[model samples]
Target: MAMRKAKVQEQVVQAVARSNPGDRLVATVHGISGPAPQLTMAFGFIMLFVVKYYFVTVTERAVVVHRAAKFTGRPGDVVFNLPREQAHGIASEVRHGRQWNSFRLLFPGAAKPTRINVAAPWANDLGRLLSALGAAAPASG
Candidate 1:
């Protein structure tokens, strides 16, 4: 099982790399939307449903957010691209009230930060990757 998981991860990394030429992947976190019961009970069901929509790629120069239709049965979209220099930080929090674990990309110029409820299992890996990216982010002049 572990080997299979690793193989799948490799494939995912390769696919992302192919689509994002010139960018080197630093890390990836497979987001999970929680169990059926939790998803059904959550207010953000729609968003959570697509939590596993795509893998989040942290590259040397940018944070690429891609949405794949394979998970949603709808045409995918490139949600957004945040340059490392512009990202102020990455924040992860547990909303006890909602029983949600969320991750946000902070941008100084933006009024609101971009946020997502990170699937439970991938939380730690994602947090670490984002933290590394934050630390490595180019200083803004």
Candidate 2:
């Protein structure tokens, strides 16, 4: 299991590093991409067919996300990319009276952090991401 994790981690690092040559990688994770702008929350069920996975790559200079239709593959079109300077900690809140394994990207000066977000459900490495962004996540709903 350790070997597999290392191998997959290496692949994710490589993919991010290839596109962002100058930035140093911090952490990377796979997650379910957030809903599209045109689609309302009422239609979230349709995302299952439109997207299968999203790869979020965090580097010293930025936090980037790439959408993917397959589980094991390179990053596709760029979905979300926030530079470190404008980035803030990830917010993980309890919703529906439960701990949803999801998170939202925060911006230091943005009035509404969740206004334009690239939320993801596979956000288990919350600590790593928060540390990289240098902010605390509010646990409130």
Candidate 3:
């Protein structure tokens, strides 16, 4: 399982690298693509219904979210390429003694923010992932 994850992660990095040759890959967190609040009751059900999860990756230049295919977990398409400046408003919370990170990814020119729910084990990586996103974000001058 670890080997497969690493392989898919490499593929994702390679895909992002093609469009952003100079931008280096930083962190990636796989998340359920929906509102955390709404999915509270049917979280497990929703996850089971989901055919693809968002492979949210942070690079030196941007925060990119891709629809990762099942089984292989390879990235399918570039769903979002959020400018570092727009990388804001995500928060970490503890619910029922479990760590959960919820955020709405607002892509430029888009009508709405894409909700991403990250649960523990995966949410365990949020500290560094969030740091990478913030580290590359443009200063609000």
Candidate 4:
């Protein structure tokens, strides 16, 4: 009986995974390198750095939730949902962000997964982007 129950649970999880694949989560870092000609060259390096460290795509049975934090300058949490089998691998990367950390989990009782931390300079723009994404996610979800 226990084995039978386990098989059923496994099947259910597989069904969920087949329906919702993982998504990619990317956190772009932006800051001034210097000024002009010199800054332009430096900016290239900065972009490369950001691309290498922060280009994450949550693939295979996952959902991304962008959370907005009440802080300044730090990026908000971009949470990803993973199949139960893949959940363990996600924890480490989720906690190792330069500006923000993330975690993988099942749906919380009421909260969403992805979040963005807005800075004073970017508050207005970030707020709008988040709102738009939030509004759009429901239909996609």
User: Which candidate wins on TM-score?
Assistant: 3
Over 4 Å off, model 3: 1-3, 35-52, 86-100, 135-141
Q: Model 1: runs farther than 4 Å from truth? A: 1-8, 32-54, 70-76, 90-100, 106-111, 135-141
Tens-place lDDT digits, model 4, residues 40-115: 3467655433321111223343433332221222223443343434433222112222332222223345354322
TM-scores for the candidates: 0.56, 0.58, 0.66, 0.19
lDDT of 1 by residue, 1-141 (tens): 122435545765666666677788776654333343265447564644544444566778767666644333221355556776664454443232223444555434567655555444555556566665653321111
> For residue 100, what is the lDDT in candidate 3?
56
lDDT of each: 0.52, 0.56, 0.63, 0.29
lDDT of 2 at 69: 43
* Model 2 residue 96 distance off true place after TM-score fit, in angstroms: 12
- The segments of candidate 2 whose C-alpha lies over 4 angstroms from its true place after superposition are 1-3, 34-47, 50-52, 89-100, 106-124, 135-141
Please give the range of 10 consecutive residues that has the lowest summed lDDT in model 3.
89-98
What is the alpha-carbon lDDT for the whole of candidate 1? 0.52
Q: Write the per-residue lDDT of candidate 2 for residues 49-85, one digit (tens) a residue.
A: 6544666677988888766545455557766678877
- Predictions ranked by lDDT, top down? 3, 2, 1, 4
What's model 4's overall lDDT? 0.29
lDDT of 3 by residue, 1-141 (tens): 122556767888888887678888878777666546345446755565553477788888778878876555678788878766667643223222155555555555767766666655555455567667553221111
Residue 104 of model 3, lDDT score: 56
